[model samples]
Target: MPDLAARLRIEFHWRGGPDVVFADITEWWRDPVVLRDLPPALTALVPGPVPTVVLGPASRGTLLGALIAAHLGVGLVEVRKNDRMALHSPFHIARDLPAGYHEGGARLSFRRALVRPDDRVLCVDDWVESGGQALAIQDMVAEIGAAWLGLACVVDDLGDRAEVRARLGVRALLTAEALQAD
Candidate 1:
């Protein structure tokens, strides 16, 4: 795995209860020289059959997915949080929310047309912990009859959760240990 924590400056800030570490990859996302490095790094983990499409959930996943798709010369599919597309399917997701919600969860949806039966999909995310979003996305991918390539993230914060690790088999550029290091 690439030592992203060493290359990038990660800062710690208080979210609510305690300190939350954020990897400041602002330049990495903006500059091509940096972003171009990600595809090779990620594809090394999911290298076998060429994936047909890259799927990412609403928000930051879109950016990471887009870069991967472009690198692989495939299509990018955006999974939205709300009903943004005409023919969309929704799935319930529960995770650690950043306060304001006593109950933590949200509904995410994806356009049905973005995926085709024969399309091999690789799910991408900015950060993954509970694997809730990936699980929900897996259901959506199944509905479309697409082959799931596996989950990839900029950071895998799931710690030692073997269940989630076995399920998503997440390939990450950074781990919680690396990201949380001061």
Candidate 2:
């Protein structure tokens, strides 16, 4: 098998054009090579301590987080999107996003039990663009009294948000620019 970057480029596609460009990553999840390699690749992106648990946003992030958590022999906490559903606990934490990449504003919440004060957390996701969700996760981590390690993603398109990037210690397998290169 070739390198992951080469495989990603081969399978990834950008739909539409001059006005709206949509980045399609569904194909990446279908490929066995990508599924098996993504966990380790994402793990390497961390620039801090080994996380005791992984916090993944709803949907795609949940899948990616599960894989990474399993690979690292850790636990996973799924942060729901715009959903109040959470594990029955008084310690549940939620953060509201004023703006997001897709949703104008959303709520992200998770059970406080999954993450503890002693646990170190790493947020895993398919992509990180605006950093809105990541910041929310960071807040949840704090509310749970857990230590925030960093964030790992498949694509990092945060533009010039140096402060967010530095604060999150964001790392990625490919830059959004890489996917756009044809």
Please, what are the lDDT tens digits per residue for candidate 1 over residues 1-182?
Answer: 33543444333221343465444556666655457677767777875688999988877898888988999899998877545343332432222223332245666666667788898889988788778888878877887788888998877878889788778768887776765554
TM-score of each: 0.78, 0.93
**Model 1, 137: alpha-carbon shift in Å?**
0.2
C-alpha lDDT of all candidate models, in order:
0.71, 0.87
**Candidate 1 wrong stretches, greater than 4 Å:** 1-5, 9-27, 84-103
Residue 18 displacement in candidate 1 (angstroms) = 4.7
Question: Which ten-residue region of model 1 has the weakest summed lDDT?
Answer: 93-102
lDDT for model 2, please.
Answer: 0.87
* Number of the top-ranking candidate, with TM-score as the measure: 2
Writing each residue's lDDT as its tens digit, candidate 2 over 95-176 gives 8887645748887888767788999999999989989999989987887688888899999999889899999889999988
Which residue runs does candidate 2 get wrong by more than 4 Å? 86-89, 99-101
Q: List the residue pairs that clash in candidate 2.
A: none
